[model samples]
Target: MVATGWRPKAGNRMPSPSRLAGLLRDGRFVVTAELSAANSADPEATWRRAEVLRGSVDAINCTDNTGAHVHISSLAAAHLLVEKGLEPIMQLTVRDRNRLALQADLLGAAALGVRNIVLMSGDDVTAGDHPEARRIYDIDSMQLVEVAAGLRDRGTYLSGRKLEQAPSFFIGAVENPFAPPLEFRPLRLQKKVRAGADFIQTQLVFDVPIFARFMAMVGELGLLDKVFIIPSIGIPRSARGARYMKEKVPGLHVPDSLVDRLEKTAAARQADEGVRIAVELVSAVREIPGVAGVHLIGIKWEEGVVQVAEAAGLLPRPTFSPRASVGGHG
Candidate 1:
């Protein structure tokens, strides 16, 4: 299938303003993806994965040692992705870094043409390749968001040091609505927003009713007007893939109906059926009030994600045109 994707022209040392911010502020439906992990020495491996998502997503997220697994630095991956002509939502997790490292990297990202950043409290080291690695909790995600906001808005550091030029950042935070204590999820989102989050990307969504209720509470709390909400949906490649998400992934509610549909299909056709279900899920996510967009994450079958985007009529995605200023949601 032909992948129709748009990329910000790469060449100038000067970084452009954030297209992701502009699109969301203009009331446009944004499409983003958590790019498949890349670990090769060169940028080709990452670029190829991004190529599949380009047509469907407006911005691609580079994970930060996801699941505590080690890979190339998220910053390096993001810089390479920028060079490859793709926008990178560079994720900064507090799991491995202290406040000093976080602040420096945040500034470094701005200098390297990365305008979108997401703050996350990542998984423990035991979850990945290095169980003995030390954990740093000098600050949490909310504090990190505050620090980023200070740099973006006031041009000062947590130490009160001043900068000649502040980095323009479109800050983001992640939330898990599918998890139990659902009511507290929106409340935490409110705190994140107050801490200077411009947008919220929810955990993988499978149960629509639960998400709808979460959105309703978000609306009731009057947070709908404060931050953009983008729900994530993983494209399962087969019945087995769907079952894995339900059984293996924590805090996710994958209904039996979805898994059953894919399971009953022939093995050869299950892949195609997976795409169909994903497209339908995207459509369902769009109808809910206060949903700014949908983020599609491809597990191992990145190609299947491309098909879902095309099948859902998500091609010719919103152009990545930089505005003069990265607008603050605050």
Candidate 2:
């Protein structure tokens, strides 16, 4: 059963809540995919990708200026996904916006029919191509959760201003269990939960033992009953890609054994090997007691997302209620 206060009302007359939210609330395993907005100004490309992923995954996540390299805004991309009849998890990062901008975007996104949102602190501009860009983190991701939940439940903004109508949103946040000072990771998750995170999507996790330890800690803290936990998994398309992630990415942890497996495979077959490894990870993660679901991050490898989900036995997604609110605009 879903924790109290998180379940959507059965009699809700609005478009049914997002399928992703409903599944998590019902204690059902879910599969979500991430779609990177193209660097170019073509919305069609993103829509086509969402079209291909249709019915294969529960929801598609639109990243917000990932790596600080500007692309289509996450809200715009999410809107396009909604137009295509796909459920979108709108990613909101705190790196580039102040409190006012963030609050405005939140309301605007909800008004445009986005129901699911993932809050992130975001990567520094130094990590992206534009090192000269100014960084503006007026509010971190943890606080953003509090603000969002206020808008949803209290019908007020962070400033205590009441709204004529509150937006119904399924709040989400990200976690990096493999990050340094591993012992404190679960505690960090607790903070997010306290701030009103309904679900958590972790960073790329290749070390099962480490992730298992993280989950164990979460269970110990009784967070397993508080929020849905979904760890992110990725398919390394090439040996070079694997190496870059292991070395360049700060919080991501890619096991050396997996990197070696990719190194031994031929370049042409590396993609297939990557998919196989991802499938194995998915199957393994599902067995973790507290894991509510899996989020596949198929960066630049869209087709692999389908293959991984299907191979991991996550295909043939459970039927969502037809009465389910299509999108929450009000």
Candidate 3:
């Protein structure tokens, strides 16, 4: 795959808002995967990832500088996916943009026919190569969710300015159930739902009990019906990769037993063992009471999503019929 750079499409608009929204509303177990680290050297980068995920995942997540490293912008990648006849869950992070820039991108996404936006606070600039870079968190994730909701639900900006056409956004927010003060995580999610998060995506979860407990609390708080929950599972390429996530990635945990299991396997077989473990984790999470679906992150190995989705029996993703174009940019 080659790297690429881009802006929004000139006049590409979809007939419907978001296919993921329709699937969640219909109670389908949606599958999604990250389009990993798209760079600027190749224009075909985004589609290459999407091609592997096509028909295997319900939607692809165009990440916004995840790990705080530079790449093709998430909005641009989302636009590429849309142009490819694929659905993208575009991510928006406040680490490098003020509210104005953030809101502008929200409008830009709507104009491109990209309907879903997941709000995030983002990783620290230190986590990336440019350690000295500054951050501009004009609004946190929850506040950003509120901001997107205003544009969609109220057709106005945070300044109360009106829009001729309101954006149709299926807003989403992230949570890490494995983080400390675990009990408070549910209460935190409660706040996001109140702020207008239509759906929830979580950080990588290796411990099923932790995720199960988190969902149980959400269910007990009456949050099950308010927001759809899609848990993320990160597939390590090897035992070394698994160890890195446990030791380096903040707010994520990799159990010793899992790592040891991978280590016991032959060197070349470790990758397959990791994938086997991921498939098992997917199966386990599927049995959780409130789960709407799963989001798999395979780093650079995009095909793993297809393999896990099929092994976990989430293949044959459903299709949608977008309504007649609102004709904004047909």
Worst 10 residues of 1 by lDDT: 3-12
TM-score of every candidate relative to the true structure:
0.91, 0.92, 0.92
**Number of clashes in every candidate structure?**
0, 5, 7
Question: Against the true structure, what is every candidate's RMSD?
Answer: 5.2, 3.9, 7.3
Tell me how far the alpha carbon of residue 2 in candidate 3 is from the true structure, in angstroms, after superposition. Answer: 37
**Candidate 3: stretches off by over 4 Å:** 1-16, 322-330
The lDDT for every candidate, in the order shown, is: 0.82, 0.83, 0.81
Ten contiguous residues with the weakest lDDT in model 2 = 1-10
User: Per-residue CA lDDT of candidate 3, range 252-271, in tens?
Assistant: 87899988888788889887
Report how far off residue 30 is in candidate 1 (Å): 0.8
Candidate 3's displacement at residue 148, Å, is 0.2
Give me the displacement of residue 207 in model 1, in angstroms. 0.5
